[model samples]
Target chain A: MIERRIQSGVGPKTGHKNEKGVGCLNIIVCIKQVPSTSNVEVDPVTGVLRRDGIKSKMNPYDLFALEQAFLLREQYGGTVAALSMGPNQAMDVLYEALYMGADSAVLASDRRFAGADVLATSYTLAQCVRKMGKYDLIVCGKQTTDGDTGQVGPEMAEWLEIPHACNAISIESFSEGAFTVKVNMDHSIYTLKIEAPCLITVDKDVNTPRLPSYLRRKRAGNAQISVWSMDDLADQAESHYGLSGSPTQVERIFPPEAHDDRECFKGSGEELADRLYSLLRQKKRI
Target chain B: MAHIEVNQKKVTPEIAERLSSVCPFGALVVGEKGLSIESGCRLCGLCLKADKDGVLTLVKDEPTVEVVKSSSRGIAVLAECMGNQVHPITLELLGKALEMAAPTGQPVFVVVIGWKVSSAVESLRCYGADKIYVYDDRSLEHFEPLRYASCVEDFVRKVRPSVVMAGATSMGRSVAPRIAARFRTGITADCTGLALREDGDLVQTRPAFGGNIMAQIVTPRTRPQLCTVRYRVFDAAQKREGPTSQVEVMEEPDGLEKAGACILEVLAKPKEPDISEAEVIVAVGRGVKDEAGLHLVRKLADILGAQLACTRPMVENGWFDPRRQIGLSGRTVKPKLIITIGVSGAVQFAAGMDKSEFIISINNDPEASIFNISHLGLVGDLYEVLPAFIEKVGREEPVR
Candidate 1:
């Protein structure tokens, strides 16, 4: 749990400001490993994705969150910790984060954490954050490519009983233990000031993520990564860890029917263009 | 505990092999117990369909939450306010909620949370809501997820509605989960379809894995089952002849002033119309290789007076704003005419614009999947085709 150390002279109406001072921000970035390719196929007869040797990589969206964390750390002297919750292989993303300049890495891996939906997954990560001790801010990608649900970050904030902002495009500045963030809300953009000890999920294209530095990788060789299981968490109840903790369940899964009824036209470009023009006019779609 | 029960007598070597192969997560194995379920099983229910001889069954322990089951009633729609007016998606959700409530005779409630939202609440009156709950205050002018969620939570706690829904907009996506988390209930995001069972359970159907498959989700054990649907998935509620809903002014919830985030300023995007509202769209994809290729497509769009859109890759490639992206993660558009150039029509992209009245696809590859969903498929290179199309459209009379 984070300590909300209210500093003197900062009025209560202005929101809580940590006593850690301005330049010593402690940030935790949550990352995930997703299937490298989006073109995963499902077997026709069995109705299951063919998962026989699919490679995995850090989620493309997470790179934005990591880059945001790095930018904050660069501007304000602070430590950026990269955290992930997945199988043992998920450490690859943590190492990738380390190579990209994260000060430390942690992984929450347990067999009991399998089959976790968004609720359970966020609960588990929140528990891990609690066990990790004090921190000012938590960062996450807008959503995962596989799940496509942008709820985990806010849900985690709920479990931590902290405030959260989503779809953040940029962190404009930090002062008095609060950060001003610009969020892209599709039709409009909001510039908001969120106090420290909160969570923010960054949208994609926030910044150009830096490539893993070879020198940094060499310097951080064999850097220890803390791995935590369910036993290591403050919440030890089995019911709140994985499948049991998840309130929503996948009742059924089926392939989307492909529409195949189409009129194919084969001709020269000019002919096709003329054909399309006339068809559009005839169909009143021009 | 929920577990898969495999009937050993019905399991043969061939059956075991088939079940094991059908298990996407490799949670099935042919072992000394004949056929066993492992920990990796996600309860996706694919193996049950694969088992021809009834060899598998999913055993779920009944939830013991009778109190919640008995208390929850009606369906509530969180009518999101855009600026001072109600968002169109809120009307769409009201339409859906009213439809779901008709058969069960359950009342449909609308919650409007915003400052100076009387006009918005007044406009919602003719939408057939049984009651419109308004949480109007000066501090609620800008959307703070926690404050907005607190207002909605107060209504939910008091009414104990069986289901609560909101639009899948940025505000909805941010606030719905927080509300759901507060109640410790399930929340499904970007649901494409919603249905209510006789037992009052909300069935939320949504696409997953980049629109590769559709999954049906249910929150049987939780009250006020939460879900969000994207815009344009359902029709907006038509206003009735006269106002019918009873308006209840709600007091601002406690701690309203202590929101975690403060909106310093709101910058409304320049009036470039959203693609979801576009009548005609000219969409390009990965096949439009370079900026030169994009230039040709842009010319075509200009000639047609159509909005220019693109697939996810084109946006990721920095060729277009993310708002112009049409896919599962982006906007869902049902334009009157959508001309897809060099697009292979990945399911994720198709899921967005498939409902368009007319689809014309131009791709060099004859086997491109874009043709499958297109009304007219041209088997030619975009480089050769776009120029001719542009020339013809420019010379012709304005269609719009």
Candidate 2:
């Protein structure tokens, strides 16, 4: 129930030539709450992951990304806004971000958002960012620890109409209005430039995240967090948002059953090797 | 460019010039190539063809040429094979490299950097490497992307094997791209398949466009045809006859002296129940509904001794943790039994566990495409089948 306000109507834009050092660069980092990897347990009866009493944590990668955002804010004046979209409980990860030095946090939580896939998720997130208004740079982890597809960043970029740099190697230089980054492509490194209001994904190498500071942790530990539901966003369209908006859906789920159960590859190493050689030869691979 | 009429219409540019006093459309009334539409032809679909190419597509009642980007070059494959564990994909790459190299008759050499001089030398033979280059030093135990990159770059400078195959494990993912940066080469990641084209170029293929599209990528300009493939993409080559291994160890520490090992040492942690090894996998994704649903799925998996897993999205939502998530971002699993319920099969996840022995799928939608790769697909609710499966297996077990 704490009152949240955007400090200033418009902030100084970092990494842009026009605004050098006059005001703070309002920054937002998107984070997700995920199941705790450290204490993952499988249910014995149904072979499903046990999540009833399992703990949740800030995504493993988002911490590094938020740390990078905080460092950028420290070097240049800025406010780090950690935002997320999930159920009501997603506030926990948001709090973790706030504890790490985020100036503000937003949780777009609602029942309508359930079963939303990446494309819809990105659209919902883009709407939230638009709600956040003007900012300098947007930092996100290269990919969520769980969804490893890495489509959300590009999808968000497409929605925001901004350039997205994936797997950034280094930000050679960033000023109030200008930025230079050596981005890691599949194989090649591309040195790219985008004047303020750009999006970049941070990898483990961007910057090591710090443990929560005493002052910030103390304040955030008791901070009254704000949660917004789907109806909260004004002019929220239902045609293409959340699960209803997702074009792709999970068709089925099943366990793999072996076609040929010829498990025996009997013999010693040399003999087995010869027999394998024959099998591979029969397969026309050798 | 001039276009002539097809079928029946006939009017030459010379005839059009003579008849210019009558024609209203600006372009030449007729030419040799095909029909020339003038200003009046506002892309209206007056003319169309149903040929296989179907170059012309009717969009909004107008003929718009269907411009498509051909499924061109396969992605680059950065094969990583430089360590003590002797990465499985290293042989997968050799099989791939040999296949790719056969057309070009290019030699294959590997790069190795570990603590032991003798062991690193011997490991290459079992790996089927033509010539193994070694940079032995106690300093090179852990994988420091920056330093390890320089060492690999040093090897690239000498051996320069086309399609440098390295194991795309955690170490390879870190160092391969950095070294690729040094060579200004392209690196395709976790390629499940690789081939050399008739033109003697290495063709790398990996999942792209959100696991729905399988993209084939290739590097046209780079020298050491770089690639990085995941461990289980291809089956490891079977051990060959006695010592078919031709191995060579490189001695020049040269520029590597500056690339001092910032790494102290790498300690292999005790292995856990790797998601990749689960004989029976019951993976749940975002579709699992709620916390109660997650518990239900777990109850079913427990009865089967099956490992519980989730999609990346499910993990992001705190439905499951990283250790229990299966996909490109987590561990790649190829269990003997894989049962997916309410999970859409994405390429990233499929690549990791596509080699599973038998795949059974359960989803409400009959068109749910996981059935395409599944052995037995049931079109129904997971809630119904999961509990029944657990009961069937339970009843089958002896009273002991």
Candidate 3:
């Protein structure tokens, strides 16, 4: 049996300095471009995804993150700079962010950054964030629809040596260089006050993201979007940006097997209900 | 490091076209000098496998850093405690770890970290762990990511385990990547399959691209390969009678009390058991339409003593709690009986509950994909079928 010891006065303290010391908040919202449709199919013979006419769109979850940033900036008098790391085509999402009220945009486009796993992807994003300059908050979507790995935001926080919180359902308040956020952890919800220079990944439906304004798009004609590659970043090592920097390797990729043998019954609602109820009784599943 | 090397002698125009078309990411380019691999090459080796005449081969180079393969040993599982009882997923992972460790003769260890978790630690003894590490402290009651991750880091440094696994619960997903980043190793999330290679490498298989494809990942050059497995993906370890296991109480690490974020309040949701643990579930999707439609489904669930679950759209529409959502992005459940209403079975949604022992899906659309994986498919309106089903169940003998 182990003895239990109690500690006294172990709660959170106030009056921490706003690390950046900026009068207003400077936010960076990380966004991504994912395949517009989830029904991507693979060719049987070649075993490759048929990507001929698949359109791209901003990850739906990132829209909520962008809305959160825009809302924060509206209340707190700050600038929201949208950042994305992908091919040059990714700049379209950055421009969409601008039309959605972002002050500026930055795209980290480089051939060397391809084939990055979570670790390498986060490292490259962190390097890009550092190059973009001072920011009090970095917001990201809960996860990308394609990758569906919620690890990138936290891993980026780790690389920057800052604290991070995921599944943020709401941002309650901000004062004294700390933001009180309500995080949804499956079984419970926690309200935490984190100091500045931290990262957060917001959950879906946190807010109804505002649509891109046609007027704003016309006014922002020929808006310059900064593009940074390996040479522009602080870390120029080829091993740290792409596949070589990634620790995990994809051993195989194949289409998931589908269940083909199934029974189907089509009839009126009353007939189907009776059939299902009787089937349930026969199977002992009631 | 490794790369794709294209042989010039064997490359004809026809072969070059085939090779270029074989790469999924469009990494192979039929350039003026023949086929060349570009930066988009993911080292997936598909082109090499497609090359019948040896036009392409993967070349490996000596690693820059020496891999100390002998320093690490054993598999460690991070056991989670919910209100003094060990979470079932922890036992599932331990069972998996034991199976993987049997071939290598590696020891199995379980790490429990929380406040006053002695009961949880003791409960794990019967699960067949060789040793248990406990970090029970008052300040560690509510999960602070920094503190929890620090404790895990200390354990990893001390034990030097070759592999670490945790459940893909909220807490596990939050802390696992941070620990992996601390060790600068690879961490796979939401892995549905895990196996150990003869060389002791852990291979993780997970669905990607919205469950359209499955990817097998491995950490070739990292130690303590980390992964988070979803609940019900593996069987729980059976408790042994009169089990003998060494219990080691870990000392609190330095600065354990100082966390970057301070918890202001912790609100435990009402005592609804997790959907994954339910024996019977009635799941709804966008086809349920309005609040009135949802009410009828709920009534059916109540009649059958089944829990309520939903697809991703229902959660996004704010019709149900995110916890109840089932898909690749949400929880994975393998209940004994699952009944889906007005659900178009997308691959992502099917990935979560297709393993249920009995599945019955009702949709108005005759061609909905939900019918493919379902054992009993009913093509009818949910609003009409739900009430009729409720009436039939109510008129019959009470559900057992």
Candidate 4:
């Protein structure tokens, strides 16, 4: 309980003089560097993702989340810090975030944190959040292309003890202490007004993400990304750090089977329908 | 045989009251007789976190316990139901679970948790469930993610099954992850294929990177392997006379009323037949430029007596109901015949309709990806091709 209340209004701001100086919000955008190609290899012996020597990119979904953060920062006058957890190479995504106008960036990496699942990953990220000072909001992609769980944001919110909404389609409005967000909840869309210090997992296509500005890239070329290890986190529990902290174990990984059984028929509209009807009738599926 | 016990000598009323607050399920009760452990206890160990003086202990039935591999005795299927009828995907999952259990000496169990689901019990037995665990309670009258997950987690821990399968529907998508998070287990979502490895492990396959590739995943070390198979990926389990089934009703977990995110109100969509059930479906995409284009698409659907569906663009354009949209964010359909008009098949849209028995796609651009999965591809302007098809069908003028 070492004063986790986030310090307000303290970061490299876009020195605009016309901004309101009362209380600026701090937003943390959670991002990850995933295999640029979906053809990722799994370690046969260890049942883990093999990350060595593969081209990586910022998760496609995270671009939406980052873009949303930048839009909010431009509108409400806040600092956006991009955070990620992976190998030391994960800093590449953080640097991309910086070029895309993140005020600052940080990467939490450790050998002990390897092979972590959704729960362990969320817990580790929560620990990093605690150590990285306070923020008014945390945003993440709806799900990772690699893990695709869509549980980390809410789970991390549970660990941090905050409210969160998933599948967010839009940020309708924001005021002093709360935000009105529209979320697609499967069957229907819901408009929820969540208080500050909340988390949201943004859906895809919320907005067009701006390209990394060459001017910002040149100016921020010397910007440093702070790296945090397990020791830096408030919770230094060994069991809660890496593979041991993970409840689910990867027993095995393999490629999926595919069926190439197909018959192509060329015909006119009526002929195709008649042929389809006869085929279905033969199979007794009509 | 792991069970929670309260030490009578060390327990006090104050401690008992605190213990009652600790278990979210309200398993530990403080009564005139000091304290009692109820059947509703889920063994979540939240009480252990609260009891500082060690008044309660979880006693294992045996010592020197070797590492516990995944359960090898039973396969479990989570029954997803709505409007008192079990979703067909539940039966499909049960069918696959039964197949997975066939080679191994394991029984299939179905857990149906809802009110007034007695009729579903017979259907579960017909679908090959040896035992149907029913938790029919007032608290479960409506679906709440936390409450439903707590109930399932309690049952899962009690009878550690080898594999747990659920339909990759809205409810499944929401609750499965919560259960996995609670048990600290791995779960694969939207799996298109599932198979058993040589050593009784499950190999779950799903599309990744926007359907660029299909990846196979496994839980490997987790007990009660969990996965959510997309709808229509497998055929529905055929009904058969199985062994005389037993319906065991478990006590409802208490404190479910306090679960977060109460459904204030569920605004129903406009009444329309679920497109997945349609035998023939004709869908339109962005290629259908205007209302005139939509009219022809409707005309063709009417000629075939088929249901009308669309890709995300149609719904986004306000030309079709969201319910009629087919894609990853929309409903999944596996119709006998599905024809796409002017629809360039994005992976998201293809995921919902790829399992159709036959696919015929019409796109003016020959390079459109929709041709990749189609059984019949027509490269022509829809405006020109639609009228010819309508005339050849010899259908009466469609009444608007």
Q: Which numbered prediction scores highest in TM-score against the true structure? A: 1
Q: Candidate 1 residues A1-286, lDDT tens each? A: 1223221111133223457547767889999988676565565566766555456899989999999999998898788999998877788999999999999999988767766788788888988888777787899999988777788999888777778899998998888878899998857899999887889999887689999999999988978899998899887876776677778888877666555666989889898998888887797666
Give me the runs in candidate 3 sitting further than 4 Å from their true place. A1-22, A42-46, A50-52, A258-278, B1-62, B271-274, B286-303, B317-321, B341-344, B361-400
Enumerate residue pairs that collide in model 4: A6-A134, A251-B219, A251-B220
lDDT of 2 by residue, B1-400 (tens): 1122333234444434333322211222355553343432212121332112232332321112221212122222233434445656666666666556555655566566765655545754664545666666655544434445556666666555555666656556545644443443445566666777665456666654232445455655445555667665666656766555565555645444333222222234445556765677888865578767777678657755688988878866666666787777767777777767787676566667777776766666665546666665556655555555544444545311
Q: Is the docking of candidate 1 incorrect, acceptable, medium or high quality?
A: acceptable
* Residue-wise C-alpha lDDT for candidate 4, range A205-285, written one tens digit per residue: 779999999999998999999998888988776667556565544333332222255445444555555554454346543
Docking class of 4: incorrect
Ranking by lDDT: 1, 3, 4, 2
Question: Model 4 residue B167 lDDT?
Answer: 78
- Per-residue lDDT tens digits for candidate 4, residues B1-400, read 3457788788888898777765533447888777777644434455765688889896633322233664444778899766477888888988888788788767788999888888777667677677889888766766655567768877887887777888776567656766665555667777777887766577877665343334556666566777887778788878886646677888777656554333433454454678988998999999999889989988878767789999977886788877798976677899988889889876567767888988878787776767778877777677767776666445434432
lDDT of 3 by residue, B1-400 (tens): 4567788999999999987876655678898998887765666676777788888887754555556856888899998888698889999999999999888899999999999998787778988889999998877898877778878888998999999998888788888988877777889988888998877789998877553667889998988899998888888888989566689999988777666688889998777657988999999988988879988988888877899999988887777888798888877899989999989887678778877888999999986878878888999988888788888877776644
**Winner by DockQ between candidate 3 and candidate 2:** 3
- TM-score, predicted candidate 2 vs. hidden true structure: 0.53
The best candidate by DockQ is 1
What TM-score does prediction 3 earn? Answer: 0.87
- Runs in model 2 deviating more than 4 A are A1-67, A71-140, A143-286, B1-83, B99-105, B255-257, B264-271, B290-292
| Candidate 3: residue pairs that collide | none
TM-score of candidate 4 versus the correct structure, residues matched by position: 0.67
Q: Using lDDT, give the best candidate's number.
A: 1
Q: Going through the candidates in order, what fraction of the true interface contacts does each contain?
A: 0.62, 0.01, 0.62, 0.13
Candidate 4 chain B, which ten residues in sequence have the lowest lDDT sum? B59-68
